[model samples]
Target: MSRSTLRRALRAGALCLTATTAAAVIPAAADAKVGVSTKRLNIQTGSRVTVKGHVDAPGVAKLQVQRRGRWVTLDRDRTNRSGRFVLRKRIRGAMSSRARLRLSTGETRLLGRMNVYRSALASWYGPGLFGNKLGCGGTLQAGSVGVANKSLPCGTKVTFRHNGRVLRVPVIDRGPYVGGREYDLTAATAHKLGFSGHGPIQVTK
Candidate 1:
């Protein structure tokens, strides 16, 4: 081959080698070890949830929440000298699901659930409703503990807070069917939270 042709071929070979070596050196994303301030974060609407955590390595941390079965990044923070970060998100609507943190290396660390609650009026029921078939397939007995909502998916666990008492129950039946009321708490659930006739209650979706 001519000198120029030989030189071009040599350069092409060198470029191909470099690309292959670079590809070989690339590392796969790994699962990161991280610690957050809380495992289960509970907040009411108009309030914000603050997440403070430390990763094993210094990198960008993203706070992810689930929406429509997909993970959506809502906030992010850069690691400090100690690999610690703080992320915040204000609650606008009711949301309760598993949250996670993703690092810059694509490493993901499962944090915990973030429950956002909204205010609603709820009343207790049970007396005449016992032995009724629940919408989710079960019997609503006097001792059965659950909540009733007009639209929440069946078997959806709900966290309720009232009078400084908190209770977690599943959505087992249809709603109170009363206007201006959003929840119909079972007698057992209401009793557990010290709830009576039903006034203001906080519920997480």
Candidate 2:
């Protein structure tokens, strides 16, 4: 081949190599400044909670939650055209929760805390229906704190503390068999609280 043609080919090859190297380096330099931001976190037991926030990076690859010493991946999403990310997750039990964001360049982390409490409203069921289906999909027991409510969704378990005693009961039927009261405690629950013959006791739902 002619020397001019050979020299021209060499120049084109060098230009291509330099362009590829610059392309790779530019993204890495941009990623060094990317990071995540946490906005809000509120967690509860037997309920759903939302986590919201944003990410600042040239490009984000993954988002997740770290709880109980484990990691749960949040859905992969992009920041707005303005470069921000928002995400959420549901907490189920008592544990430490944290947020993690992965960017093409690096990673960002945030921390949060939560507490789980027993259901606030627990009552009792009556006799004769001891073997019947409790609203919570379980068999009813007289001594158990099984409540009957027309409004509360069936299968919901209510929890309450009485005179230093704590009780967790499933909701079942619906009424205060005799009086126009809100709940009807079984003979057993009444006996446990020293109020077998008394009326509705104060309950927390």
Candidate 3:
């Protein structure tokens, strides 16, 4: 063969080999991506839930949880080089939930659900605290049914049934510290519920 023709053929063969190698490497890289998994399928409301799972990647990534169309971002970390990711978050409402992880180059999605129940006890706060800054970044009103929780977020709204009456209260302040009470009722709330004294009630979110 002429020298020019031989050189041209060699160049074509090299190009073909490079293309073949790339085709094989692409799928293998994708297959090496990480993923997440969970042991529990259902979670309960008014209670803390832990999401346990692992990923399947070479390094760490960011994890997240989605519930009722709301997204909660998880912390960033590395996977066990085996590409496993395990994480957890609290169940704040009575709705279905899902999770996803953003790794170095890809993402993994998982599905889950939460089951909420009525509160066994309920309460509220206001009055002498009117115009006071609430944990929810709003002014407190004596006429409004708002409670305070030490741990629950500031703007959480909980509904409960008492004396055949149903009421929903926004969480505002902090605590009762009186007894092992699950909730502390404001004076106005107590009167509205027709309960002169703190009593048992049912609550839900």
Candidate 4:
């Protein structure tokens, strides 16, 4: 081959190698998820929590909470070498916001639900009432799980939390009929949540 032809072939080979190296070094999507410190929260103003998670690509990411029906950005942080980042925020009031991590690639990954609840007074029932008909139709058995509310329609579902335990049950009956109480928990519902006697418990819609 001629000298000039040989030089041209060498230049083409160098260009192909550079292109391949550049393609191999291109960055990938973070493909990460957002996580919260807690799954359930009883807000008391000034309550704070840590939001954290990792990504495949280590970089800055936006931490956000769903508020007023829209995603609002709360803060931002750069991930460590492991692509992990942690951010802390004080909760202002009751919220049903879900947490998510927004990476620089514009991809958002859902972490978990941070359900906030309101406090309400509750009482348990079931002693001699097992054979009676439930307001929602079925017979109230000893193991039947549900709650009774004055205004909530029969069969309405209610979520209750007590002593770090959570329970979800439907309104299978009517109520305590007495004033100053919001819910009357069936014996089984109360037991599942570790709730006993009469007191305040966390409730969510």
Output the number of the lDDT-best candidate.
1
Q: After superposition, which runs of candidate 3 have C-alpha atoms over 4 Å from their true positions?
A: 1-67, 70-119, 122-141
Candidates in order have lDDT scores of: 0.86, 0.55, 0.60, 0.76
Model 2 whole-model lDDT (C-alpha atoms): 0.55
Off by over 4 Å in 2: 1-38, 46-49, 61-63, 67-69, 114-205
Model 1 spans with C-alpha error above 4 angstroms: 1-33, 38-40, 133-138
Clash totals for all candidate models? 0, 9, 17, 0
Q: Residue 180, candidate 4: how far off, in angstroms?
A: 1.3
| TM-score of every model versus the real structure | 0.73, 0.36, 0.39, 0.64
Q: What is the lDDT of residue 75 in candidate 1?
A: 89
lDDT of 2 by residue, 122-172 (tens): 344466777876544666665565667666776665553456554556566
Cα error, candidate 2, residue 40 (Å): 2.8
User: What's the lDDT of the predicted structure labeled candidate 3?
Assistant: 0.60
How do the residues 1-205 of candidate 3 rate in per-residue lDDT, one tens digit apiece?
Answer: 9999999999999999999998987864444433334544344464554444555546656556665677666456666655565655555665433555556665555444333344455444555777777666766666656666667887777665567665567776778666667777666666677655565666555
- CA deviation > 4 Å runs, candidate 4: 1-46, 56-84, 95-98, 106-108, 153-156
User: Tens digit of lDDT per residue, candidate 4, span 1-205?
Assistant: 9999999999999999999999999996445554444332334445665666666676787767787689887778888987777766676655555777688778887766555577889999998988899888989888999999988888776777788787768888888777888899988888889888898888864
**Superposed Cα deviation of residue 179, candidate 4 (Å):** 1.9
Clashing pairs in 1: none
* Candidate 4 positional error at 57, Å: 2.6
